[model samples]
Target: MHGQTTFLNWNKERIALERIKSLDPIAHGYMDTPYYVAYSGGKDSDVLRILFELSGVKYDLVHNHTTVDAPETVHYVRSIPGVIISKPEITMWDLIVKKRMPPTRIVRYCCTELKERGGQDRFVATGVRWAESVGRKAKRNSLEIISPRMKDKIVLNADNDESRRMFETCSLQGKRVLNPIIDWTDDDVWEFLRYYGCRSNPLYGCGFKRIGCIGCPMAQDHERLRVFGRYPQYRAIYIHAFNRMLAARRADGLPTDWQTEQQVFDWWVHSTRRRREVEDQIRLSEVAI
Candidate 1:
């Protein structure tokens, strides 16, 4: 099956390159307009970088630092040639305190603030694969233009009617978002990486299925555990943040059932399993503070 999938993927790769070549005018106004890649320093992103080079398209690369990423991943991204490393205004720890609650899968404000802040007014390419998630599969188009105003509103967290109208009337052209390998699968990503001998993040070799923020609630319990166990310093930072959040809640006359930092950390990493229990505890201490 792997061999067959690889064979099919090679053909698909050729077709995808042709498709991107044909979109030069629509994506960048001309063949010479350089596009940008939102490189993640992961397997898929490495493949995307190579794909852009192979496609003979003029492009640059950008990697937004989430701050919560593994040290090895950050090092790897920094080591990449000519990659622009963009950092968020606030660190993940500070964002956690400002949010007043841990980021859950449903409310991933971090992505908007950290990950998707790139490609503001320029043509940007990404390594988004339809196979990665159902949401991306349904929502992402292979090639689409993002209004510069809308992009600004998203990154700036401004979502008012006036802002919308202002953006709608803005004279600046919208940015183009290109997903060159949107149709590729996991097997295809690894195959391409091996073929090119690309050096990906070292965290993958340490048994992480994906490389992103450590202790991210969206991760599975096993993955999260491995991350916490592997990186004690980050785990300590997360626990301290949780401790501070709980203290603030207590000071505000809210539920403070999870008293210790350890308790808060335990509940946080395993909260999904006991969602009702955690929610009920929070509800029990509700007050107009």
Candidate 2:
């Protein structure tokens, strides 16, 4: 598996290197700041780090410690030298209690507050691929100007990058990012990683496909259940946090159907409909506020 890039006739590796080298100037103008590479302790981030090194560009591999990441992921991230571990001020458990709600697919406030924080006003690099999800492909771009307001985000595709000078200006107000592997396939990622002899996160060896947060809302029921089974302590932590959240709600005269943390935990892990309803209720409450 290690020397298969040529047997597969893979050229995206070369393309990715070119993309990073080409985008190097965006990292520094008169400033000495380099690209903030978002390293998530996943295979893609590993590939991105390797590509940056191969391209010989200045970059800092930064991992946003969501506090809910699997033990394996944290350990994997630590094993990588020069990776800047950026921990959030608040842990996921505390965040759930503070928000008085669990993170759901409809509104993952946790992601905004934890995983997607940092790299502000700096050029960034991510290993996001269109193959991951349709939502990402639709929202993310090869080159993007981060907006103070997300709705006003600026996307400069390879063809539209002629306005790069203007795109550089937008970075002054917010940030900019380049997705070097935006067009790469899953095969491309695994092939490139193998060629570089990267075994990636240990979770992958244990039959885990995606290794990010332990109980991400984005994960399917079976995947969540599997991770929880492997690390039941995380389930306990979440339930305990939910109990605190319910307590907070009651103290504030907020409405909730969950009488016990067990009830909330079951709904969180099993009931997608209930979670969506809660998200809707949350949105309504915000409107009322």
Candidate 3:
């Protein structure tokens, strides 16, 4: 069944490629116009980069550095040829300090600062899929809006919900945004990677289910645990940030919940415990060997 599915998917992808190629002449007529590929050094973005290259389109590769990205992911991006890295003028640490708390799903200032605003191009491409996040699933395939502050400025918007929202916000300010890979699925992404021999961040090989910010709240418990155990320094930084948040809350005379500190600590400790379990399993296997 898996093989049959792969075959069907590949055929569909070839058809899609033909359609894209058919539109290439029109797209290339605007060669003088700038397009940016938002590269995250993740598997998805890697696949997108390959697609852009294969399409024979001219585009600048733009990587947004969140400042809290996993070391492996950062290294992977830098290793790519001709990749341009943009760091946010504001650091996550600064944002957390200013906001006095870590970003949650409800309040994600990180995406605005770290990902969206960091892109240098007016038209951006991203390897965003609807299957990845709920927010992404709701976004339009293509749209144009004015930059947030400048009424006359237009930017093409693409990518997923987060990218769309970023474009919309920029449009409100008078910027345009564009997303070319909004319709691709996870399977399509992996297939592209496999077909193109594209390289992805090592973090994925190290058992990270999703690669974004080190302590992204969107991650599952097991993913966070894997991060905590595999990257102790990062885990410590998160704990320190959480501790600071707790202290700041107290200083502000905010009511404390017993679960706040416990929850953060548990998240850290639970990963450590899982790591130990894995080590034990390995040792047991060694004994049998």
Q: Tell me, by TM-score, which candidate is best.
A: 2
Any runs in candidate 1 off by more than 4 Å, and if so which?
1-8, 25-33, 146-175, 250-257, 276-289
Prediction 1 global C-alpha lDDT: 0.74
What TM-score goes with each of the models?
A: 0.78, 0.89, 0.69
Give residue 101's lDDT in candidate 2 (0 to 100). Answer: 91
Please count the clashing residue pairs in each candidate, in the order shown. 0, 0, 27
Task: Please give the TM-score that candidate 3 achieves against the real structure.
Answer: 0.69
Q: Which tens-of-lDDT digit does each residue in 1-289 have in candidate 2?
A: 3664452525777777766776675444633588899999898888898888888788889999999999888888999989999989899999998998999887799998999999887788998889999888788778888768676778777435575555655534567788888998878788788887887999889888887798898888778888899899999999989989999999999999989999988888876656667999999999999
Alpha carbon lDDT at 50, candidate 1: 77
**What does each candidate score in C-alpha RMSD?**
7.9, 5.5, 10.5
1 or 3, which is superior by lDDT? 1
User: For model 1, what is the error of residue 60's alpha carbon versus the real structure, in angstroms, after optimal superposition?
Assistant: 2.0
**Number of the predicted model whose lDDT against the real structure is largest:** 2
Q: What's model 2's overall lDDT?
A: 0.83
Q: What does candidate 1's lDDT look like per residue over 1-289, in tens digits?
A: 1223334357767856764565554354443356778898888888788777778866778899998878898889889888999989998877877777778889898888877786766667778788999987666756655664564322211123454333334455667666778788898788777666675788778777788888888888777888888889988999888888877777777766776878878878887768867787788879533
The residue-level lDDT of candidate 1 at 74 comes to: 87
Off by over 4 Å in 2: 1-9, 26-31, 159-165, 169-172, 273-289
Q: Candidate 3 — worst ten consecutive residues by lDDT sum? A: 1-10
* Candidate number with the higher lDDT (2 or 3): 2
